[model samples]
Target: MKNSTLGPPDSEAHELQRNLSNRHIQLIAIGGAIGTGLFMGSGKTISLAGPSIIFVYMIIGFMLFFVMRAMGELLLSNLKYKSFIDFSADLLGPWAGFFTGWTYWFCWIVTGIADVIAISAYSQFWFPDIPQWLPALSCVGLLLSLNLLTVKMFGELEFWFAMIKIVAICALVCTGLYMVVAAYQSPAGDVASLANLWNDGGMFPHGAMGFFAGFQIAIFAFAGIELVGTTAAETKNPERNLPRAINSIPLRIIVFYVFALIAIMAVTPWRDVVANKSPFVELFVLAGLPAAAGIINFVVLTSAASSANSGVFSTSRMLYGLAVDGDAPGKFKALSSRAVPSNGLIFSCVCLSAGALVIYLVPNMLDAFTLITTVSAILFMCVWSMILLSYLAYRKQREHLHRASKYRMPGGIFMSWACLVFFVAMLALLALEEDTRKALVFVPVWFVILGLAYRSMRQKKSEGVQLSYDAD
Candidate 1:
């Protein structure tokens, strides 16, 4: 068996530096837990499922926490493995790595496009006449330049971006609590109170079907939750920092996702939440804050920037891993002097720039955003399932390692199967909605393309081997 501690043959020449400290990892994990979906997508979730959206976020978070644990344990099991792709390749097969790596790359590209579109829309809040492509392309260019610097620069960018999100959510929760305490009434004459959660139509106001519908959008909110796993190669002290970051996911979700939604619902009631608007903005606006729109717009704008930044960072890293394993083009494996994968970053940013075109090409922005996000969510679930499957393989093949590991997954194989089942169920739920169902149907085409590419890649490799033998 290949040594788990060993990297690629040329790792000495080009390796990702371990520059991300515990603080960077922690903030990155926090940023991943609190995604742009919460800021921009929760309004629709609330409208569809009412207060039950809170439970949807919680359930998704709960399941994903186990996925993170599985990932953390597997990553810690083999320090040489940069991301889930490495382990999936090692434990499952080359094809597993190929599919997971490229799918994850595509997943973030799709998501980054959504964020790009969102950033443009948010920019329009301030500059109503500005072309959507202007802000969209500008964002891609800015992130590319920043990411091209160093891994630490990416860390700092995410750190500050995450800090902004943290502050916004905390402020929203605190302000909403104060409003509830003082019996603050909105302009619509709705009293802010905890009872507001169920007072209008009860906690599961939309019934079981509405609650089920929430999972589709709510799952997208956690798209980047496992983003910390991608930082294993760059993070300092994997054993300590990786576990620390993973363990805190549950708390972060409760505070950032559940509490923030609760505050929004309490402030405006779910029924009053404008489906197309941000409930975060609606909460403050309904509370009579004159600058609420601009404030939340800036926050959500930064929130989208943060998600796009993460997408850029993770996609490059995954590409670096895939290239090292010979799944992607070898060019992506070359790291800059600062150990940043410049080639992969450029490729990802260029793909993200396509979002600018999406704005012009797709006449209906809402439908486009929905399709993009749903596809992203589906692809993310596939990646998450791959991680769990990798964990299961680790437990079986590396039973001794599992027995000796200091950080074992909470429920071990049992939880792994449970998480897999949960993801399968979520996929079924996707079929119930027309928008998500369309994305669901569209996703199989990606797999089909990957299948063809993998076959061609293998055929070329076999022919190259045969040619070398003939020369010998």
Candidate 2:
């Protein structure tokens, strides 16, 4: 029964407080699992995969469950470890920690940028004249102000943000069900039916390539699902709350992702769901809701803002962890009076503002967004791969720990390998698209930068030793 504000007993050396309660953790998990990926990106996915996109979500969720289980077991095995970055560093090596921590930070920055960009685009729905970057920059500032507060405040904010997503999805699911049952007719004159899932093109509407493309887009929706893993140091009762959150992934996927997709497609044919606009918004309009457009618009705006808020929180924590491990600047290690990583939070927000410049520089915001998302997805895949690798190392080097642990990854080593292979397959799938292919090409540039930075730090340390010897 330790006081959460005091943090874990072994965490006195750390500045972050364990102020997140079970309710906060649970809602954070739900919110993290749901993102604008569903609201904004689903249109493109539906256009590509057709109704089969439903299965894409389910399959990805199934595979990622094992990944989450691996993460959970690793976190529980060592209470001192903050997140996957710490475990990866501990189990694998310092290089693994550096790479995972910074890469994860980059993942969120890219995602945050995308979310901001999306916010600006969504804003144009009502205020068409306002520069897109204005809203994007404004959103970042707002999130930065909120995140500067105590960790409990962050939890509260995320709790409500996630609740909004849950309510929106529930509304869509419930409304779609009623429509299907009542055979609701749309403005397009199409009758609502579950059979719309298959009748159009037998699942592969555009062909194998189209179905394959779904994997590329759908994977992004599950990006923030691992946000729960990052809460290891911040969550109270990790043993109980962490398991509750991680175990609920399947249910969340089924209800929020799978059922929502099914509901949308049932109300509107997959082919008819435009790729350029949100299917959720489109569905409400077709359902004859008088204020459908405004309602969905508000939901989507908040959804993007929620994702951006998460990005700021995650990037700051990752930066804090990196600074503590000497992977990043020492200043990021400093926490505010409230125990929040104030410096890291500000740094991430500053980087996030670059998205506005991107919008200004790149005439086609859509292309910029696609590239940013692809990059984020690639970086996240690498982080996920590292987590799996760390698990394998743990089993080999710390087998006794596994035996003593209460929570264990199901399917064991075999599933871990399978998940790795699946990730590789996803990278290949991502490469199929022209835009995403560019992301794969650019990923190595980051590793090159890290390699040089590591070498320079090593050289500096060597010089310092020489100086000490001369003085002696």
- Candidate number achieving the greatest TM-score relative to the actual structure: 1
Can you list the residue pairs that collide in candidate 1? none
Those runs of model 1 whose alpha carbons end farther than 4 Å from true positions after fitting are 1-5, 9-12
TM-score of each: 0.98, 0.96
lDDT of each: 0.89, 0.87
Pairs that clash in candidate 2 = none
Query: Compared with the true structure, what per-residue lDDT tens digits does model 2 show for residues 334-366?
Result: 888898989999999999999998898876867
Of candidate 1, the 10-residue stretch with the lowest lDDT total is 1-10
lDDT of 1 by residue, 357-388 (tens): 88898857677788889999999999999999
Evaluated at residue 442, the lDDT of candidate 2 is: 86
**What is the Å distance of residue 140 in model 2 from its true position?**
0.7
Global fold similarity of model 1 (TM-score): 0.98
Residue 26 alpha-carbon offset, candidate 2, angstroms: 0.8
